[model samples]
Target: MNAFEIIGGKKLKGEIQPQGAKNEALQIISAVLLTDQKITISNIPDIKDVNKLIELLGDMGVTIERLNKDTYTFEAKNINLDFFQSDVFKTKGGGLRGSIMIVGPLLGRFGKAAIPKPGGDKIGRRRLDTHFIGFEKLGAKFIYDSKKEFFNVDATNLQGAYILLDEASVTGTANIVMAAVLAKGTTTIYNAACEPYLQQLCKMLNRMGAKISGVGSNLLTIEGVQKLGGTEHRMLPDMIEIGSFIGLAAMTESEITIKNVCYPELGVIPDVFKKLGIKFELKGDDIYIPSQKHYVIESFIDGSMLTISDAPWPGFTPDLLSIILVVATQARGNVLIHQKMFESRLFFVDKLIDMGAQIILCDPHRASVNGIDKKYKLRGISMTSPDIRAGVSLLIAALSAEGKSTIFNIEQIERGYQDIDTRLRALGAQIKRIEASAPTH
Candidate 1:
């Protein structure tokens, strides 16, 4: 295992660019399987999860060519369907949560697909019911092999139908949309996830000759075409990372400039940070955050404590709630962080409490933070990262602490962020990666 050894209390300054969107890359890369021609994708983030998915595709006989450090061309003209039954497939496919997406494209183009139970962050009960249910609604036979812990779906003929999703699950919607785009008839999806990731997918599909409307709304209409062609796509900058940079600037009292952030696509992220009293200027396509000695949280209009919660698109993102909670530790007022999407995401607050942050974990879903207004700096401690978001949150807290801190299980953090330590070091952060010995049995 590798751990991050950091010396805190150093102000970082410089320009950092957010990587390509991880969530969107998962969907867009999987979409390449829908067409036999070469599809070029640019701005792909060099992260573990995304790379795992790409490697899975390559293992399935997709001809992948790396045009540059961040660009690739994938041609799925001769995919090996037999590989799905191999043990190597089970091990590789089961390791990444994004592997679930390939099933939709495979089932759509090849009439069948199988995947081992996917693994990802141990945040909460991330159910696959949404994906399977959507596939079943589109005339596919769904099966779960309990013995092998695998999911299988096959369709001789897919006929589109109206699908009202139980929830606006982002990955579920993307999977269903991929299958629906190749179905025999029109498919209407209501209550679909309308995040920019989905919008980019739909637009890319349209460019590939698939007919899809309602690009940026909860309702999507797809007119199935005979087949899709190849198209090029450039992923948007990761909004989660952008939000993380904002919170990091406030917590560390650092002056940083985040370059090439798609400002308009980051809906409500800037405003949400502003509500936490973090100030920044949007210049051209960059976000500039100045060093701040103190920032005060804003209260509600009716004098109630400000309650920030995650919702579907156009609302605050759940991924950044951890960042918000961490940033609130040094603010001037109190705020309630309601993590509605995931029950266990707020559990990492205990580590913050250990660091001298005044946080009350109301429950598994909510936390109330009383900002210390920089009266005292957080003292560093050794801790283990729980998930990607919480891992980054702990790193942020460590960056602003009064002494050295060690974060174990940094693999969880590397799964999302691309070269995080190197990027932070560019801004003068005293952080380094060290390999840790495995524990004995």
Candidate 2:
């Protein structure tokens, strides 16, 4: 096991280019299976999850040639050549949420796909009913064998149909879209997650000759194509990582610039931060965050405490709530952090509270943060990470706190971000990557 040890209370200043979205790149890489042609994807983040998915793809006989640190060219010509229950089922699909999507493409093209229950942050009971529901509507049968911990799927010549997803689940919509791209007739999908990730999927499908209308909206009309060909594509910059960078700059009161921000794709993030009293300058596609020693928290028009919450696409991302919570801690006024999507996301506040933050965990999904307002500074303390986002949030808090702090469970952080310690170090953050010699029993 490895941990990130931090010597707190240092200002972070330097330019950073946000990595390509892990979410988008994952699906784009997987969609390569739909063709025997070469699909070269650039700007892919070299993170643990991506590596795991690549490993899984390799076991399935996908030949991936790494062009550089950020480029991967994949050719799935021998698709299903190495099919085995062991190679596919043991993967932590539930964790990626996107992994469940493999069922749709595999079933539509290969007539079968065995996937284990996906695993992710135990934030809440994220239902796969929407996924199974959409696939079932498209004429795929799902066999839930809990004893085996995988979904046994089999479908023959799926037919396009009207699918009104129960909850507009992101991965659910993606699964249906993947399955429908090759189905007979037209597929009308409403309430789809048409965010950048889904948009990239649709775009790739379109390049492969899949006719898809409504590219960036909730309603996606996919004209099924007989077969999708290979096309070169690049993943979009991670909006969540950009949000993290924004929060980091605000906390450290450093003027830092974020390169290639994908200005239009970030729906409401810039405006949301402005509402929180953060100042920035957008130079073309790049964002410049200015320094602020004493930032005031924006209040509602009624002078009441402000509340920031997360929702589905076009709404704020739940992955960024931790960063927002940390930024709120440094503001001058009060704000309620509502994490509507995940039940256990707010649990990480305990670490911040111990470091002298004034926060009340109203419930599983809400926390009331009374800003320190620079009136009282935080003292550093050692803590263990609970989840991916929470772990980084703690690092941000530790960076601003006085003295020293150590973050355990580096695995969770590695699962999402790549070489985070090294990346932050480049920005002048004093952090050390340490390994724990003793194994957990």
Candidate 3:
């Protein structure tokens, strides 16, 4: 275990490029197992989750060539289909939520796949019912009991059928999409997660000869290809990272530039933050965050309070709610943050409240943050990192606090973002990565 110690109340100013998205990289890595030809992916983030998936792929005998930092070539000339029931599942799978997707491709190509209870943030009960439903629709059968926490799936001949997922579960949609790409006939997936990550996955599959229609929309039509060829692809920059940097610059009141952000597909991020009174300039693909002093919450013409919440694709992502909540603490007015996706996400507001923030946890999924502006400043406090987004949000909060702050349970943080501390440190953030406790000699 490791912790981040940060000395706060300093202006962090500089240019920092966020690594490739961890969520996208996970699916990209898993897609390698779908083909036997060479697949070259560049700008891959070297984060913990990606590394763990890479390790799992290696265990399956996927040949990998490290071209250089942030780039890798993968060829699955001969993949090891023997995914044994070993300590590997318990020790590794629980840490990676994306490991659950491996079951789809494995079952599609090899007829049988078993994944340990997939691990991820403990934010709430993110259901896998949709995943199982889609798998079952595609001629696969799943066997799992939550009490014992075991998962396995098998399908001899994947005859494609229509899959209407209960909810557009991101990983679930991805898993089904991967499996359906090689099925016997066409597969129609409705209510699919069309986030940029899923879009990239579809595009990659399409480039590999899979017929896919509607890459960025909820309705996806897939005509199974007999075989997929090796195709090179690059991942889109992380939307959450884009949102985090925007919130960071706003909170720190620093002038910064974020490069290579895809503007057309930002999906309400700019407009959502604009509602919070955070302003920035867009030059081509780069975003310029100027040093802002007074952040006033934009009131509606009706003269009521402002409320922001998350929704599905083309909607504001739930991942950035924590970051937005943290930055809103220093703004000039009040705003309500409603995180509808996951339960227990707003629970971290207690830590921010302890740091002299004016916040009221409305419920498990909602919080009312009353901004303090420059009149009050947050002081350092010790806290635990509960999940990925919450952990990074706390880090931002700690950085803007008055004194030194320590954050434990940071392995959760590493699961999503890549080298967050190092990137922040490069921009004058006083943060240090240290062990949680010393080992006995």
On lDDT, the candidate that comes out on top is 1
Compose the digit string of candidate 3's lDDT tens values, residues 279-301: 99998898889989868887778
Please give the RMSD to the true structure for each candidate, in Å: 1.2, 1.9, 2.3
Task: Write one digit per residue (lDDT tens) for candidate 1, span 1-441.
Answer: 899999999999999999999999999999999999999999999999999999999999999999998999999999999999999999999999999999789878888999899999999999988898898889999788999998777887999999999999999999999999999999999999999999999999999999999889999999988899999999999999999999999999999999999999999999999999998998999999999999999999999999999999989999999999999999999999999999989998888999999999999999999999999999998888999999999999999999999899999999999999999999999999988753332
lDDT of 2 at 42: 94
What clash pairs does model 2 have?
93-118, 94-118, 94-119, 95-119, 95-120
> Model 2 compared with the native: what TM-score?
0.96
TM-score to true structure, per model: 0.99, 0.96, 0.96
lDDT of the structure predicted as candidate 2 = 0.82
Runs of candidate 3 exceeding 4 Å displacement = 145-148, 436-441
Using TM-score as the measure, the top candidate is 1
User: What lDDT tens digits, residue by residue, belong to model 2 across residues 353-394?
Assistant: 999999999999999988877776678887888888998888
Question: Residue 57 in candidate 1 has what lDDT?
Answer: 94
lDDT value, residue 405 of candidate 1: 92
Candidate 1's TM-score: 0.99
Model 3 lDDT at residue 168: 81
